[model samples]
Target: MQPLADRLRPRTLDEVAGQQHLIGASGVLRKIVESGVIPNMVFYGPPGIGKTTVANIISQVTSRRLYRLNGTTASIGDVKAIVDELDTFLTPDGALLYLDEIQYFNKKQQQTLLSHMENGKLTLIASTTENPYFYIYPAVLSRLTVFEFKPLKKEDVESVVLRAFDTLRGESGESFVLEQGVAGYLAAACAGDVRKAVGAAELAWLTCPPEDGQRRITLAACEAVAQRSSMRYDRDGDSHFDLLSALHKSIRGSDPDAAVHYLARLLLADDLPSVCRRLLAIASEDVGLAWPQAVSIVKSCVDSALQLGMPEARLPLTEAALLLATAPKSNSALMAIERAIADIQAGRIGDVPDHLKDGHYAGAEKLGHAVGYRYPHDFEHHYTPQQYLPDELKGAHYYDYGPNKFEQANKNYWDEIKKKHR
Candidate 1:
């Protein structure tokens, strides 16, 4: 028997539930599908959310040839073989090559696609349950636009559940009774996974046989099935990113309570590494220079989490997140480096001054390298001043001190030193 998910697969963009941001009246994907001109892009989100289904629908709607290659099951050789055959295909209108779980393709395997995506033998419509930017080769990612799929809102899931009810009646040709709140309960339990939602409804049917009257589906029946399923996390879904953002921002915003709440969400999903990695970043980007010790503390917590492993790992992870949340916040260090790097990249400055160049080489003094260099220790306050920036950017200031104790103190000292030098 076909799975309820496949049976209820949406044939048109309008038939697709949720993703209003993508398939709504003004959605980018809706426009692409309607225009009958689709580009190579990846549908990125958690599983059972219509990445593959959307790809299939696009091909059918546009009447385009489709070539599917499973990244996990298909070898590099298999991909090449398909592409080679496709190069000589009779279809004038190019095909849509649907690669499911494209994250499984390693760098070497994905490298093969650089040519096809460039030459356009086919339009690539890849689907992934992992973040494409992290798992996919940069070359592959560069060639394809990423369309993020967010989790379905509750009302959206309820609408799908209501539709599934109709589909079941037509399929079974029997009167089915959906008890009050049963559909909503199922929808809520599935966590935006339509397959789970539809399947649970189907599973509930098996629990109670058809009688002379309507076979009513109840929340109790659905709850038994929900027990086997885990949390509603699509690790690659936008919710994952959203919750992480919430956690980071909460910590940076100085609310440890909100930070811990978001951290708990990831812990339930067993995504501690992502949390830890974010904590480390928050330590630098948000807490930066203000505490200065936050980076080391987060790093230790990462080690402890890995060594201790999960459940228990949540402890150190929580500590790390809280530490970041409570730490003094400043971006002076991060912003300063960013501006300096930008300057170098834009070629906004000349070569290092002669005084700043390496002068401890043969005959270097004769060429006046380090000619006017002043050792800071050779003067009062051990802070003799001289031009350190490139000749074209002399006295250029990059580091702007925020009004934080750590940075403000340093700024005052620099100001005083500059006064003495002047």
Candidate 2:
């Protein structure tokens, strides 16, 4: 028996589910199809979002010769062989070449396709799960129109489930009824992936006993087959963004346990890069001078992520998470920048005081530059505030030291220096 995904593979755009933004009546792709003027395009999206299906649809609609290659398995020689085949069947009307996982193609292999696409020898349609702007070569990217495909929605997944169930009943002639909750459960567990939804449905049918003709699929059965009780935490989805928000708030709130829990969730979901980036933000925003080492630790973790990649990189990420959770919290540095930005946006522009302007340049001294600027090093504790700020905001104070240990110590140091100056 054929697998559900294969059995239900869409043969036309009408049969393909979801991605209304691309395939709807007034969608960009629909316009391209109606015009019969398909350009070289790169399909940037997650897996099983009908990239290949759409490519096949285009080939069918246009009656173009289609040559498909899997980047994971196809060799350079295989690519050349296909190109050779294209040459044999070469006509005034060009052919379409579909490359799967185009990111997996090394620089040289990607370069090989440049001329073919440029000269219109083949209408190139490439697909990848990764962002092409980062992974694809610049030269190749310049010549391609990039289309992003989003994951299938829950309703779309449910629709596919019903269609699959109908197909199964029609083929098997066995009355199989899915419980009311089973469809929703299966759809949710699939995480916006139609392929997984069909697989789970098929698994439930296969595992049912032959004697139980009236067997109904349950949540337990679905969970057992899907290997998850509910939707998995998608790093690019709502849960990911929400958890990061909570993590940042917890760190700012100085709640170590809550911060740790959020960190653990992100780690388990394999969102290490985003975790590191957010931690870096927290370091500057919440830690600042209160715990200066926190920023360095976060930076080091980001570097470690670049060096180690996944699995091993989780270690440094864990260290950074713990440090951020326990670090003394302050928002003074964050407030300082926020205030500066607010002033700028409010049209509080100020000229560089003549005394502070560059003096090393030829005409600097003639323009009264560096005329009255005091050298702070010559003063006690290297401290001086000789009108550094503009006249309009001379007495403006942005950073108010918080009640953290490091902040209090810094406040004391500044106070003593101010006393000497006064």
Candidate 3:
């Protein structure tokens, strides 16, 4: 039997669950599809996000010969067979091939399509759940334009679930009772995968018990079908880094609640190392010299998290997040280093002052190394103003006092000392 998802697969761009940026009116993809000249394109994104559906829509609108291949099983021989069909009367106008999971194809397999693509014998629309640039052969990837398909929103998934429900009802010719919020529950549980949402709705309906001569689709039934909320996280994909960014930004923004929420999401995805690393970085990058001790405290929390692992680890990780979010935030250190590095990169690195060079070596003092170097410790208040920066970067200020109590206090102390000494 055709699965409900396949049966209800969108026949037009308008019916696709998400990715309006690509297929909506005024979208570049819509313009391309309507132009009747399809190029070799790669659809990049997670599964159940309408890559195949968009490819199908393109095929329908262009009235081109359509061929489908799964990278998991399609061999070079299969590709050769398709190539051999190019000259046949059936595909005189060239063929449109939809290659799903293109990342699974080996380099050689990917290269096999290059000649056809180069000569306009075939227009390829390949899709992959992984980052295509990382997986596709450079030669093959260079020739294909890439478009990203994002996950469906909750409302979009709910719409799909309700549509499937309506279809099932029409097919069964029976009045089914759908409990309030059941559709939304299934939609949220599917984690933006429309295919999963539809399948769960079908399962819920199939397993639903008939009460009073009607199969009541209840929230409990939907939950049973969904099993558990699926996390939209992939260690190698964008979601992983996106969640990490969310956590970092939340902590930097001083929202402990949001910080913990994002932290929980990462932990639920079993991304302990990523969270720990980001937290450690946040200590120095965001908290910086404002709360110098924050680095040590976060480090301890990270250590405890690594040793504890998972369920127990979440506790330390949570503590670390709370500490960071509530701590005084500053990026002065980060800005200082970045500015210095930018100067170095731009060829602003003048020779180190002779006074700052290694003077402990024999003959170094004779060579003017450390010749004029003043021992600040020998001066009053252990202070001396001397040339430290390179000649090219004289008087350049890198470090800025951050606007925090700790930094401001230290800044005031240094200001007084420098004022008296100079």
Query: Which candidate number would show the highest TM-score if scored against the true structure?
Result: 3
Kindly list the per-residue Cα lDDT of model 2 for residues 172-260, writing each as its tens digit: 77787676788887887787778889988888877874455555666678878987524446675446776899999988887878888
Candidate 2 worst ten-residue window by lDDT:
229-238
lDDT of 3: 0.90
Clashing pairs in 3: none
Top-lDDT candidate index: 3
Q: How accurate is candidate 2 locally (lDDT)?
A: 0.81
Q: For model 2, what is the alpha-carbon lDDT of residue 100?
A: 92
TM-score of 2: 0.67
Cα misplacement distance, residue 248 of candidate 2 (Å): 6.2
TM-score list, all predictions: 0.69, 0.67, 0.87
lDDT per residue (tens digit) for residues 1-422 in model 1: 89878888998888888888998999999898889878889988877677777888888865557788988898988877767666455446656678898988888888887887787767888898877878998888888989999878778888888888788878888888877888888888888888888888888877867888567787788898876453756666756887889998999899999999999988988897788888888999998988888899899999999899889999999899888888889988889999989988998879878887789899889988988888878888888766777778876788888889988888888898789768
What lDDT score belongs to each candidate, Candidate 1 first? 0.83, 0.81, 0.90
Give the worst 10-residue stretch by lDDT in candidate 3.
55-64
At residue 164, what lDDT does model 3 achieve? Answer: 97
Query: Candidate 3 lDDT, tens digit per residue, 1-422?
Result: 89999999999888887788988898999999989889999999878888888888888866568899999999999999999999789898888899999999999899889999999989999999988878998899899999988888899999999999899988887679888999889989988998888999999989986676678898988888897656778898878988899999999999999999999989888889999999999999999998999999999999998998889999998999999999998899999999999999999999999999989989998899989999999998788999999999999989999999999999999999998856
Give residue 89's lDDT in candidate 1 (0 to 100): 50
